[model samples]
Target: MPSQATTAPRVALVTGTSSGIGAAVVEHFCKLGHQVLAVDFNPAGKAVAGKAGAVFYEADLSDPDACRGAVTEAVKRFGSVDILVNNAGIQHVASIETFPEEKWHQIIDLMLTAPFLLTQAAWPHMRKKGWGRIVNVASIHAQVASPGKAAYTSAKHGMIGLTKTAALEGGEQGITANAVCPAYVKTPLVDNQIADQAKLNNMDEQDVVEKIMLKQAAIKRLIEPEEVAQLIAYLASDAAGAVTGSSFNIDLGWTAH
Candidate 1:
């Protein structure tokens, strides 16, 4: 029913489809009648893609070659990649003084570099089509910083830069590049953060949620994955043709102050 009103079905290559924001994006695009190629390291992603009628490609984006291969596989199977959702991410929480070097490279590769690689691989196809949409799932961390998130903040910040750069390059073509930056959301990643923050802050998980997480947020709650998915769907739609080179914050006012 939701798929009935689309201009035509296009292919969307979405990373991190195992769960959370990535999973929600897959569902949204499918409802909008697009063919989705779901990429994730987790095997669970296969089932998620199957249920959503998306093709699944399991990949660890830390490897640069894999990022290129993912786009190629999508093109091979679907003909073109009209939309790219660079939503894959992992978090590492620790003071910069105590962060591991390997973890830094790993986080940076997956969050920041992989998006660029995937976008590069998908560029020619979009150029051929004369239209494309790229939605990078950045975070409030992309705009602001937190105490124990050195690696995460750095990678997310880079994502914003990548989004802007992509926008400038894609402008001449009909491709638009944008980012959806959300505040803390209820996902396994955030749940892990809740637990880690409690230990790091010497508080219970509930205190971390109430005091730390919501302290700067006006909404006083975690954002839902569907809420983010809706925005991604919009950016990937024709309605958002002029919305490129922008970072839209769904941060619940975390950055307002």
Candidate 2:
């Protein structure tokens, strides 16, 4: 549990809150007494949000208008958004030579473009309040890459770039922006990827897990969603105001090499 002062009640808007890291983040914030706005296309998001005492909004983040609308609704319901977590993303694996053009566009739009628009929409509100926290959930792939993940890797890299630039711009206003880069997390996303990789490479799911996913981690273990959520909760708090324009890694030493 986070300290009460560190989790002081604030209005937080977290995208991709339906499950995994995003859902954990929402729950953490609510436990810290923050008013949360949970956004996701998943129908179950509303129930999850309700349980966390957060207001829920269902929308496809790939749509720029929907991203903007979510921000608008948050402002209307909460008066202001003190924190924003850009966590919605998707993965499509294929070699560069054979990657589908449509998949490339969709991945980039959802992971990179949506964050840009949401940040743009929320900027003025944060500026008015003179305090804000924006944490982008990037991946270790933001700095390192593996085969068959060009679209996912590129979008993660772009997210880091966006985080840095936004941090620089928001610093003068007491608003902070940062990115958290983590390795394979034990989430539905990774579970789905394991199955997808098994089918794609004609290997057993266990082989995919051992031979591919954990091959590079020093710990050789998947990270828990709550672990990443704890870091996010810290960054979203008033205590992290000084920690901006940076990429913090929770990759179990994957990038140390």
Candidate 3:
């Protein structure tokens, strides 16, 4: 295999940079001296990007055009996009019968289709440069199932398929694709889910965390955003040039059983 040819301070385009894992990834890459284009639909992402010394692009990633445009904007700003992190996602919990069709589309589009579009847009640049890293932030749900997460599970599972395909096609060109499947992380998203779960189950938030979210894990704690970010940083680095088409689980032993 060809050695990773991308030079130092490569440009990275990360989606969903407004908060949680996305914000942490932007901060990590920026701290590593890489030029980062932080894309998020949230206006507050501007502050995050600014504080991290990254350029911010506000766009709804669910929009197909916005996905492609983000790649263009990154290249226009930084000359080339050497790393792409598809991390934008939203969760809607509902039974299959009660899940809204529009909500399903929203989740699939943002979490699944957006990554494909962004990857398609970034492929040529990476092919030309002979090096690229594409990290798809999947979930433990990608490999497992939850009762009310029909759409989320489907999208994450599809993300792994996308990762494998990209890895196979990009392997010879020095572009590696991988997925990071993290269990519940300490983020606003999970916090909101905990509140909702507590109300639904008539239990305290702490109980929901201990009995519901971490039930399968031997280690009973939520993973931190920075912890996940460290793994993502490793997969995105040239040191992981040969690690492709695999899903690394940071599931706090959730899948051990």
Candidate 4:
């Protein structure tokens, strides 16, 4: 990265900031002097974001109105929303044949549509300023597929399309949109997956980590949340001004194959 520029600190709205990649992002941006509005449905996120020096807004992204309202709060409280990070997500791991239709809707609503609505809400402010950044925290599943992650893979793939479309529309306005695709990370979500996969596959937790989780990656370890956060901070910075409409992977070589 280039020497940090002396740009004015931005007003940022970040979703999913209660834990995992979201929490890490809140910490990183606060450390960089940006005023962050951390939004999460989890009330626990309130204290987490507060500790990171960010204002907290508890809103469930799955509700379309909540997405818009979160952005509204950011602009209402702070002057403008210079950056939006859509990182809230959940997962279910049943085979498509047995996948719950409700689970599909829930995942899609939160991961794909909410980002679009939040972007819609934030677009005008960004247009007014002639500068903005939108980063979607997608997954390696955006590029590749696996058994029993139908809804997850679908939402991630849709995210790339949403990001590219936003980039095309925002290109001339100095607003860049992109997605960061990370593989399995050491997050509470992944911890749940470890336990779930063990039960689903009739394997021990260690066996699931080695055989199911790390089997496809050349680097056989879970990614740290901070690793993903670092990449996101760079993408949101002026340093990546020309990098948009693309998916940057920190997938432990999972997609290299």
Candidate 5:
């Protein structure tokens, strides 16, 4: 009844679009004839969105007001945020006792609280339209944990909880919420982690990824950003209408063990 997913153009608000999976999502959605509002804290995101033919909004989502403002900007520019992708995040590696209090709070605020605020801000718009899709980009750590990643793991785990809650609340209103938990992806974010991982493991940077990051992965390789983007697109499409309250793992069999 709703027609195929690509028949109509939906407005999408995607965060962390300066590079990596965020940029890939922007490009993919735009190619599907959707209007996209690309939000990122990095000023360079303006250029990335321009290249992708998406409107760009720069905001530090850790700020509660900024999180709400991002959704407001999307509605202001594209009429409504028909699709919301909570994909902006960062990683900090340290033992629980050694992790800085400020960093932990920042990570939780940005990765966990921001998504909640954004969802709250977008809920009314979606309810009014009787249709919406929410995709949270969680990680393999959401379901499992590793040492020296206290804040990152905690926030990702929280994200899956938020996704489930949103799915439950949105079900009767024609909105669906889901999370994609991917293993290490070939993105700048993961690349940035290599140094910290190497330092934490006392290993060479190259060996850190091969011997550590992908060691448990049956595929023995990092996922590409575009690959994760494809899964997010599918979850956001009308074809996935029945798929809600689910956490799909793109972990290359790492979780299969």
Candidate 6:
């Protein structure tokens, strides 16, 4: 059981909460008794928020101003943010040579810049209260590499850098910043990727999963979003106060070899 004080109705801001890992994290925090602010541009977010009993904010995090607005809205609705989960992201598939400039900018802006801006806005409040948790939902791609995902990889890599810097600055103020980097999780995002990889590699969906996605994993299976949510819940807990500036991998041994 969670402590009442630790699991009390603290304000939490979770981005990209319409589906996948983001949605799972929001639901997990809500179950722990936190008042969550779920932000996502997806129309499904409203329904998810209702189910989770969390306040919802619909906004495109790719926009810097929208990122700031998310923080502002969370503050207004929930009083002060005790946890900020930077999870809004999208994937673009293309090699460096063929990657569209616009798509590159969009991915960077959304996956990397939005986290920076949101953290910036939330920092003062966290600093003032002398307690905070910032969890960046990065990818294993942040450390490893795959073909046709330069923009996605770069953005995730940048998130790790931001996590370290913020952790250094916020340590004295009782704020902790860390990232969770996972390999392919069984989400709608990865479901879409199955078809994309099939077309890209001229293979069937099963072949793509077997020959590509799980080929590097020692576990030979995709991770579940709930598993990632459990890790986020731990990081947000007071028990994890000493863990900061770390990239905890749930990568199924992808990086082992």
Measured over all alpha carbons after superposition, the RMSD of each candidate to the real structure, in angstroms, is 1.9, 1.4, 3.0, 1.4, 2.2, 1.8
- List per-prediction Cα lDDT, in the order shown: 0.91, 0.90, 0.92, 0.91, 0.91, 0.90
In model 4, which runs have C-alpha deviations exceeding 4 angstroms? 1-7
* Better model by TM-score: candidate 2 vs candidate 5: 5
TM-score to native of every candidate shown:
0.96, 0.96, 0.95, 0.96, 0.97, 0.96
lDDT-better candidate, 2 vs 6: 2
- lDDT by residue for model 2 over 55-147, one digit each (tens)? 999999999999999999999998988899999988877778989999999999999999999999999999998999999999999989988
* Model 3 pairs whose backbones collide: none
Give the clash count for model 2.
Answer: 0
lDDT of 1 by residue, 1-257 (tens): 13232446789999999999999989888887899999999999999999999999989999999999999999999988999999999987777788889999999999999999999999999988899999999999899999999889989999999999999999999999999999998888898888778877888888998898889998988999988998888888887888899999999999888
Could you give me the TM-score of model 2 versus the true structure? 0.96
- For candidate 3, report its TM-score: 0.95
lDDT for model 6, please: 0.90
Question: In candidate 2, which residue ranges exceed 4 Å CA deviation?
Answer: 1-7, 200-202
lDDT, model 4, position 196: 69
- Give one digit per residue, the lDDT tens place, for model 3 in 178-218: 99999999988888787767765678987988888989998
- What is candidate 2's CA lDDT for residue 124? 94
**TM-score of candidate 4 on Cα atoms, chains taken together:** 0.96
lDDT digits (tens) for residues 103-155 of candidate 5: 99999999999999999999999999999999999999999999899999999
